[model samples]
Target chain A: MKISARNKLDGEIEAVDLGAVMASIKIKVEDPGVLTALITKESAEGLGLKKGDKVSAIIKSTEIIVGKE
Target chain B: MKISARNKLDGEIEAVDLGAVMASIKIKVEDPGVLTALITKESAEGLGLKKGDKVSAIIKSTEIIVGKE
Candidate 1:
């Protein structure tokens, strides 16, 4: 899909934590950092997410605060 | 700061485009992905963000729908 957002990380699923209404999916990208994505439990189940699965962690936010110190 | 959201990407600022009330910040992370952030123009100014600045692209969304094909 052609998303307006430019950040698209091709990553491998490392872990999937599902809660009652929310789910957290950890993806291991090419870098050393692990990207965590929070989505609805229903969507997570619908996606059939599992470890070793390849997915794209697409992030599109309007409130990405830029911080510097 | 300890944010509830888990996805934190350490990146360097590549470009900053400010509009009337909103702004777009492009950041280059360690991986081969360029993260784009959209924030308020006031907040962007408050952050004093500029090119070559190091920042963290924090993404917190409760509706991060997971997609698969």
Candidate 2:
């Protein structure tokens, strides 16, 4: 599936190993304990998203929540 | 953080219990093996996203990957 044009959130992105070809992306917010991410089985064959590699998290607005403290 | 506009993808949405107040949103695609999701530590108190809740999976272009079989 091809995804284009979506909301972007500025946060620290980190990749975590999920065994085999699956991996998880971690988005660290500045609010201390808030964390978000997009998990996929899409392997990082050539994308070069390593454990410590930095990347931008692209989020769709519909996937986000507001007014939560 | 407030998000208003973004791209959305149609998929089967399900909420999984992640212990405590944290929960995981599962996006089931038609491809069967390809599962994707946006994990948020944000609780589902008033959002009403239950285990069988039906919702759409919003995705951002930058978070998508192409060319893999």
Candidate 3:
């Protein structure tokens, strides 16, 4: 997955796998209602991400929190 | 604030305030570490956002979780 960067706040990126190393890199932000992540454990060990390794998911935009679920 | 939409998962938007009444519009998702928002509630009453109203904050990228402070 790739996106390098975006606007309004922050959305930078870098991702590589298949033994390419450089496995984790991400940043996306928008905090109004609540939505924040600042990950960096060597990119979770270059994407080795233990405990589970099924990545990719995103949310931003004033931390969307609509009412009356 | 506006962004419309983005990819890699989901990032949609539509924010307008200034008595224009069209305030809420957001969608950001990245559920690996936990950063998911789907706000609506008429855009939190068109940005009037009671209970406090100071917008803008963002965090995505596998829900960013790093250890070893």
Residue-pair clashes per prediction, in order, are 0, 0, 22
Q: Write the per-residue lDDT of candidate 2 for residues B1-69, one digit (tens) a residue.
A: 545536655566554544333345666655653344535446444566666565666655655544333
Each prediction's TM-score against the native? 0.85, 0.38, 0.25
| Better by lDDT, candidate 3 or 2 | 2
The sequence of per-residue lDDT tens digits that candidate 2 reaches over residues A28-69 is: 655653354534434454465665555556665555678866
Candidate 3 per-residue lDDT over residues B8-65, each given as its tens digit: 3333333333234334333332332222233555655654544322333234444334
Off by over 4 Å in 2: A1-69, B1-6, B20-22, B32-34
Error of 1 at A23 (Å): 2.5
> Least accurate stretch of 10 residues (summed lDDT) in model 3 chain A?
A4-13
- Put the candidates in lDDT order, highest first: 1, 2, 3
**lDDT per prediction?**
0.77, 0.53, 0.36
The predicted structure with the larger TM-score, 1 or 2, is 1
| TM-score of predicted chain B, candidate 1 | 0.85
Which residue pairs clash in candidate 1? none
Which CAPRI quality tier does the interface of model 1 achieve? medium
Q: Report DockQ per prediction, comma-separated.
A: 0.58, 0.05, 0.18
